[model samples]
Target: MIISWWKETKSIKEVFVVFCRVVALLLILIFALVGLVELFVYLGIAQDGFIIQRD
Candidate 1:
């Protein structure tokens, strides 16, 4: 029974690692998209009428 329990525990840890990897990947993708948007605005590629003008 002890050996079986150890196997189960290992399996659970493996599943947890996979879950973490997937979540990390999703977060990285989200950050990459945000960075791309920021780059566009920084480079003046996303001009809109909302840009305020002053005398």
Candidate 2:
């Protein structure tokens, strides 16, 4: 199954499209991580005095 899918993406256009999709997914993941960190800080779960300090 994987081999067939790889073969289908042998064309340059298909490969470029796949690359763009992967980059987009990575960007989304990074944004999500940053958002989560911000949320934790806003909730007082993470603070400047310590790694994590509940108020």
Task: Give Cα-based local distance difference scores for all models.
Answer: 0.64, 0.71
* lDDT string, candidate 2, 4-48, tens digits: 376577666777787777789999998987778778888889764
Report per-prediction Cα RMSD to one decimal.
9.4, 5.5
lDDT of 1 by residue, 1-55 (tens): 3433544545766767666776899999989877776677678896432233225
- Candidate 2 Cα misplacement greater than 4 A, ranges: 1-7, 48-55
Estimate candidate 2's alpha-carbon lDDT, on a 0 to 1 scale.
Answer: 0.71
**Residue pairs that clash (backbone atoms under 3 angstroms), model 1:** none
lDDT of 2 at 48: 45
TM-scores of all candidate predictions against the true structure: 0.65, 0.71
